[model samples]
Target chain A: MILTVTLNAALDVTYRVARLHQGASTRVLSVAERAGGKGINVSRVLHTLGVDTTVTGLVGGLTGRSLRQDLALAALPEALVTIGQESRRTVAVFDEAAGETSMLLEPGAQVTGDEWRAFTARYAGLLPSAKAVVLSGSLPPGVPVDAYASLLRLARGCGVPAVLDTEGEPLLAALPARPALIKPNADELVATTGLTDPLAAIEQLRARGARTVVASLGAEGLVAVTPEGRWRARPPHRVAGNPTGAGDAAVAALAVGLANGAPWQSVLARAVALSAASVAAPLAGSYDAVLYQRLRDQVAVGPFTQL
Target chain B: MILTVTLNAALDVTYRVARLHQGASTRVLSVAERAGGKGINVSRVLHTLGVDTTVTGLVGGLTGRSLRQDLALAALPEALVTIGQESRRTVAVFDEAAGETSMLLEPGAQVTGDEWRAFTARYAGLLPSAKAVVLSGSLPPGVPVDAYASLLRLARGCGVPAVLDTEGEPLLAALPARPALIKPNADELVATTGLTDPLAAIEQLRARGARTVVASLGAEGLVAVTPEGRWRARPPHRVAGNPTGAGDAAVAALAVGLANGAPWQSVLARAVALSAASVAAPLAGSYDAVLYQRLRDQVAVGPFTQL
Candidate 1:
């Protein structure tokens, strides 16, 4: 079973409007709420793809309660550590006509040291039964920047492969632990390595002790480097829609491929196909199963070189 | 004691940001949550100003619970009626340097007929003990525009003075009930009467059976036309900062004055001063008592006539 860790969870609220007017009130045509966090999103995609996943995170207050209730309603497996502060909420105002998405994110509840300790202990307890652990999302307020490093250490201690999906300080700090895999988007790779080239950035991450590195390039697809080989995967065509959670869907596919013992090339191909299929779905981290199967065989994989 | 009704209540969340760039992520400098709705704001200001006030409104779900907890912490008198749906939340992004505020308002929880009947009955039950009832804010979804009119009918049935503070169809519909008082902002008056002239709009409202009409004109102060007399109260200077809830503060002051048996002129003077003081305060509906008192005596009151 896969374990996903989300330090800062949120109630994701999406509002559909004809257009977003700056400094003017706009009526929402539709509103939808769901439990969210980077790891939660990844786990949701994995579950929808028929993979078993467990989500663990810090949550508190009324917003936290709502998040948990929503997850239950969705029948998602989760282990939430209750804290003192309420979970944050993220508002995405989607302008349908313009196809622009505006986001307002709240810097969720602050987690105290004791709360962090409790969550770490809980995570350690669950690590033995988990085949792989995916650490994702931003660190909540009051959590030390090196918090992910501790979790990485714990995963190593339990002999569990861990996938680190985050950026900036936490991602930088966790690198010394030599996580099994690290997924950084183009911007995150640039921020971490000061290298605009995806190949150099992936090499920089590998030099920092990442066993494998995957760099997700929006429409261009993904470039991955593993101990076995370096591979590139791309979709046949770009699907038009919101690309918000496509990376998460890619991460979910990568986790599934690794669990199913797929090779580097096969994994990259499956990940690219799943990510593309997600863009075709209306909701984030969800895709049509039939479309996913159809596209999985069409995904092209080739050896990655300097270009 | 004064009773204030908020048919559509909200948990107002304000985020202080350096700047808001649409479609890009923003880091909030500070976050604040307050119980909000037109009537609730008035009640908060009234309590802060040492007026005996009771706030009655529809509340539900976790957001509603948070609102109640906040009110309890503030030691405000409240009788929040529980509904099936959760209360809505409003996000206000304040840019300090530019002195601009962007707002995202959510359509509040829908009120069922049974819920409306329950609240109306509850309001009627409290009428015998209430000195005056202030029906404020917009109607929630599922609640007809005539909801306020029904409340006004109940107030008239009990011989209780009802002050209506609303806009659009609800305001227009409640006017024929001949409420003891109605406070409409300059924009609301324009929309309701299609008249740019404040005096002409006041005359139109009075002609429609409203006994007293008070038109709030932000920096220009307030204009009131009553059966007894007509008065225009203007402050000596324009108060700085946000004028978001100044109108609610004015309504609160007017309710206090009427409950304390103040004359029409004193009500106008106190309302104007209180509104100016509210603009000076950080949170909406809050005012400096000393500043309000100092400005009260300096307010210019004169007969309002169309020139």
Candidate 2:
């Protein structure tokens, strides 16, 4: 089973309103809450696809309890470590009329040194039974900057392939550990490598020690630089829907491929299909099954070439 | 001890951000959360003033748990009834740059018949030991429209004076139950009475069955019509700050007056002083102690006569 780690797990709250008026009171028509974070979203997509996965992370306080309950409700297996501070929450306000969304992300609670030690111990325990481990999302305050690097080292020691999905310093710090794969979206790729060109960014990431670099270009689709060769996979068509979790959906496909040792072409094709299907669906970690099936075969996977 | 009932209690979450950009992700600089509701605010004010008070309300789910934990941390006594559904949350985003606040109110969980029954049973159990009770805020969906009326009747049956602070249909329904005092702001008074004049609105409210009507006219202070006589109390000068919980502070003072059987002039003076002092404070359920003490004597109180 693939183990997913979301160090900065969140109770994602979505408010549906007719419209948002700044500096005024808006009565939310509806509220939808779920356990959310990059790794958790990846696990959700994997679980739905009938892939074996376990969600492991740090959670605490009342918000943490809600997140755990939601994970249970979703039937996602979890071995979350409890901490002292309350977990953070991300509020997304969706304007029905404007068809737009705004978000407020709380800076998550500081994980103390002791808590980090405890989490690593738990992660080590879980690694023994894991085929592959995916470390995703930002490091909460007080956590070491190279948190993923440490986790990558632990996974490597256990002979488990690791997939790292994060951006900025944490992403940069984790690269020297040589994770099996890394998935960075277009913006994240540019930010991480300081390169505007996707192929160049992927190359830079691979040189830094990532065995495989899969960069997702929002509407453009997946570009992968791997040991096998460089390849680009484009979706059959652009799907109109929320694109928030499309990249995570792609990560789920890549992790599944990593666990099964699938070829680069098939893996990129599956990732692009899943990413597009997720866009067709309204919520993150969810995909349109019919669209995914139809697009899986239609996804164009070809050799990558810089124009 | 005064009893404050908040059927629609909330975990008030405040996000302090440099600025809010619509349809974009804003990273909150800080987050502050507290248990809140109109009645809870009244209880908080009363508690802060060293008054003997108990907070009674309907709270449920994880949000409720957080609310209760906050109340406990504040050292406010409570006998909250639990329900199956989660309590609501009100998100207030304070834009430091613009120096303004915007809010998103979750349409609290629907109270089932069983939950309402459970709440009334709890209220009934608490009323026998209470000197006075204050019912405040809006009713959640599925709760009977005359919920406050029922509570008022129970308070009256237990020989406890109740100060009802609500608007629209619930306020109109509870008026016939003859609460000891009803505090309505200028807009609520006008809406309730369908009259443009504050004095006329106060008269109409008393005519309906409220023993007294204390109408808050914002910076203009308060105009109270009671059995003793009509009186007006104005603050020494306008103190600019947040006015969110100003009325609740007045209700706190009114509930104290109802418990002590204070004269109308003294009660109105105290209420107006506390209201203005609350306006000078940043958060709801809090007051500027120095300002409150200063304003207590400086407030101009006299027999009110309509021009």
Candidate 3:
């Protein structure tokens, strides 16, 4: 079973309104919410694909309770650790008239040193029964900058392959532990490596100690640099919808492939197809199964070379 | 002790950001939240003034739990009834650069017949020991339009005075129940009675069965038409800040005055002073105690004459 860790889990809330006006009150017509975070989204996508995934994370307060309730309703297995501070929430106001969405993200509560110690202990306990572990999303305040690095070491010690999906310092800090795979989106790749070229940045990431580097270039699709081989997988057509959870979808596919010892070409193809299918679905963390099936064989996977 | 009922209570959350851009994600610098509703605000002000006030209404789900937790922190007494649906939340994004606030109001959850019945039973149980009852704010979906009227009947049966603060159909529907006092701001007065003139609207409200009508006219102060006398009380100077809970502050003073059987002039003066103090405070459901004291006796109270 795959174990997913979301240190900064959130309750994603969407408010539907006719129009949005700055500095004025907007009456929301409808509200929908669900448990969300990078790792949780990966587990959600894997769950839908009939994969065994357990959601483990730090959660607290009423918002945490609400997130847990949503996960239960979705029938997603969880082993969340409790904390003292309330969890954060992201509110997206979708304006039906303008066909736009504006968002406000609440900063997650600070995790104490004791809480971090407790979470690491829980992660260690879960890693023993896990085939692969995925650590995703930004670190909340007060957590050590090397949080992912510590978790990666634990996963490695347990002989579990680990997939890291994050950006900036946390992503760079975790590389020394040599995670099995790292998935950074186009923007995140440039921000982390300071290289505009995807192939060059992927090379830098691999040199920094990642066993495999899979970079998601939004509409362009997946580019992988791995030990076995290098490949570039492109979607047949762009799916125009919400791209919130597309990266998590790719990470889920990569983790499954890594656990099953799949070929690079097949793994890249699945990642690109699943990513596009996720964009086709309206809600985040969900994908259109029909679109995934339709695009599965259509993704073009070929050898990658530095231009 | 005054009993305040907020049929549509909410958790009011404020997010502070450097600037707000439409159709973009804004990172909130800080977040603050507390229990809120018209009647709850009234109860908060009354509690601050050292008045004995009990907060009662319908609450449910996790958001309700958050609200209740905040109420407990504030040390406000409560006897709220539980329901199956989640309570609503109102988010206000304060843009510091532009010095403006953008608000999103979530529609309250639908109240089932059983939930409403349960709330009424709880209200009935609280009314016997209450000196007065203040029913405020809009009705949630599925609640009867004449909900305040029904509550007013119960308050009267228990020999408790009722002060109603609402608008549109609910305001019109409750007037026939002959509440001891009805407080409507200038906008609510015009909207409820369809009269451009405040005095004309207040007269119309009294004719329909409201024992006393007090109209809050924002910075212009307050105008009261009661059995004892008619007077207009204006603040010494215009104070600027948040006006979200200003009217509720006025209702709080009015409820206290009615409970004490105070004269109209003194009641109107206190109401005008407290309302302006509430406006001067940054947070809603709070007032500037210093400003309130300074403005208390300085307010200009004179006999009001309708031209």
Q: Give the DockQ ranking, best first.
A: 2, 3, 1
- Tell me the tens digit of each residue's lDDT in model 3 across A1-307: 9999999999999999999878999999999998989999999999999999999999999899989999999999999999999999999999999988888999998899999999999989999889889999999998999999999999999999999999999999999999999999889989999999878888899999999999888999988889988888999998999998999999999999988888989989999999999999987779999999999999999996763
> What clash count goes with each model?
0, 0, 0
- Mark the 10 consecutive residues where model 3 chain A has the least summed lDDT: A298-307
Compute the lDDT for candidate 2. Answer: 0.92
Rank by lDDT (best first) = 3, 2, 1
Positional deviation of B275 in candidate 2, in angstroms?
Answer: 1.2
Residues forming the 10-long window of minimal summed lDDT in candidate 2 chain B: B298-307
Candidates in order have lDDT scores of: 0.86, 0.92, 0.92
Docking class of 1: medium
TM-score of each: 0.95, 0.98, 0.98
Q: Give the DockQ of candidate 1.
A: 0.59
lDDT of 1 by residue, A1-307 (tens): 8899999888998988878776766767777889988899898888887778899999998889989999898788998899998888888888887877877788878899899999999999999988888898889999999988899999999888888899988898999999888899999999888898878888888998899998898888898899988888888888877687888888888777666677888888888888888888888768767777888888889986765
* Greater-DockQ candidate between 1 and 3: 3
What tens digits encode model 1's per-residue C-alpha lDDT throughout B40-87?
Answer: 989888888777889998999888998998889889889889999989
Q: Which stretches of model 3 miss by more than 4 angstroms?
A: none
Q: Per-residue lDDT tens digits of candidate 3, residues B190-237?
A: 899999988889999999999998888889998888888888899999
Task: Itemize residue pairs with steric clashes in candidate 2.
Answer: none
